[model samples]
Target: MNVCDYRKLSISMSYYLQLFRNNAGVGRTGTYIVLDAMLKQIQAKGVVNVFGFLLHIRNQRNFLVQTEEQYIFIHDALVEAIMSGETNLRMEQIQELKKSNSYLEQQYKNIIQFQAKDIHISAAMKQVNSIKNRGAIFPVNSYRVHLTPKPGEEGSDYINGTWLHGFRRLKDFIVTQHPMHHTVKDFWQMIWDHNVQTIVMLSSLDEINFAQFWPADDTTSIDSDSYRMRFLSKCNKSDYVTRDFIIQSTQHDYELSVKMLHYPSWPNLANANTIYDFIVDVHERASDYRNGPIVIVDR
Candidate 1:
């Protein structure tokens, strides 16, 4: 997650540990005395190796007590160090490290945010140029597989077999292939062998903009044309896209299109006055050579 969340967790853990230690009523000297007794007892039992003694203690209940006592001693010593102001040096060093880390994190975030904005702007400009030159804009690859309803067949089957299947498969692939899998063992070797981003899948839309995917309409049939329309509307409402439309009259039966001429990053364009402005401008420009007015409907 985020830095704020991590900081909160760290603070909570520290508070809980301190509370536990205070309730235990054990001091550094008392804990060490218990450990020393346990060590002597283990040695008297002919366990000459310290490592074996430690392991034996770890495996046995009485030994476990000694181990815990040792831990308490270390904890108490650390607290004593802090109370005596000796840990101030370490704390100062930590503060310096944290400040450096925060600066680096902010810089990294700024660079990525700038890159995201630039990518959006460049894509929008490309769409505008394509429109002006009467060239076709490349369609985004659908994460869904296409399926036509069989004669007298219900639409639900098509939805489950194609759209739902595709979506689930893609999600599963992403989770399994995500770069952070520790079991990967040789990530650098894999990276050198294959030219690909460490994380092959984009972060979930919900993670980036929860409002975009929240309030999902589960009542609607997945196979219905309106299902995808509703999904698009939610995404657009969160300002993820300028607008989205589906053309049913086309020979392809359905064509999903996103208006990229006006993006969220740049709001000064005269042609992009509103979410519907880009469509209106395109309609006006192609009026003489085109069909009827395209209906814009709410999901």
Candidate 2:
């Protein structure tokens, strides 16, 4: 099972105890008091030990304990769990300390340069290269999975990305850049042609000075001349925004559903508490579409 499903199955013990905060129909003001108290306790005596106390109390007294004070206590316990998202910060620190740079050197030096030997490649594809964030940066061919061009298009049709080979597969995932305004058409075209089911967007549209390639919002739709994209539904969580899009090919008479999980928080020290939360959510959601290729975009 994916992490989200596993957490759902074990909600009582997970980091989302807010779901149980008002299960007993407690007053909003009282709940806030309890929540504030729980936060103070967490700040004073570390979250792990405080969480242990809450677990013990929950085990001793059932979730629906009697008395308003008891109810407040249980609610406070749940609040404690919700505020203990500090684990995200801790895990990031550990990862940064142990992160490897071998792949960075290998890709930047060897694999990425496999096809760039011909400097004329970028000049050949005027529009794509001219609009790229980084000039002269192109995906290598040998390991790069070429995106299929639309009918009638000839020669190289460039959309900057490469096939990342995993231990047992020829193509594990496709790593690409955040889409530019001019390349939005090509971006959706790539997804339509490749049958990409999941797209994990790591950068915020506002930060990149770029227009979003997807539909405007849950209430609206957008078009790429050949395809019409409409927002079907959207779920806004604490760490990420999951938007469901239905894309119809005007020329082909077929429609496809796509999940675009956008993680707007780029993880600065200020919002470290929820950084990994969106990443984990995307990972779990992407796993649901394992049958098809995933397109991952970053800044």
Which has the greatest lDDT?
Answer: 2
Instruction: Give the runs in model 2 whose Cα sits over 4 Å from its true position.
Output: 1-116, 119-133, 151-156, 218-220, 224-226, 251-253, 269-273
Each prediction's TM-score versus the true structure: 0.17, 0.53
Cα lDDT tens digits for candidate 1, 1-299: 12222221111233234324544333333344444544344436733243454455545434343334345433443332222321123555765766687665764654454222232223323532232111222211122112333367432111100111123222221111111222122222222122212121112232322113112453431123222322233234222243332222223354333221223333333453454654454445334322211212110
Report the lDDT tens digits of candidate 2 across residue range 1-299.
12332231212331223334545643333333344545556557755343455455556545423345444444544543453333333556766644658644543454343343343244434663555545545565443445555577643366777666545444657888777777676677777777777888877767356557776676766676567778888889776788888889888988878898887765442456566676676678666766557788876
lDDT of each: 0.30, 0.59
Q: Model 2 TM-score? A: 0.53
RMSD of each: 21.0, 21.4
Kindly report which residue stretches of model 1 are placed more than 4 angstroms away from their true locations once superposed. Answer: 1-51, 58-91, 94-232, 235-299
Report the error of model 2 at residue 161, Å. Answer: 1.7
Worst 10 residues of 1 by lDDT: 156-165
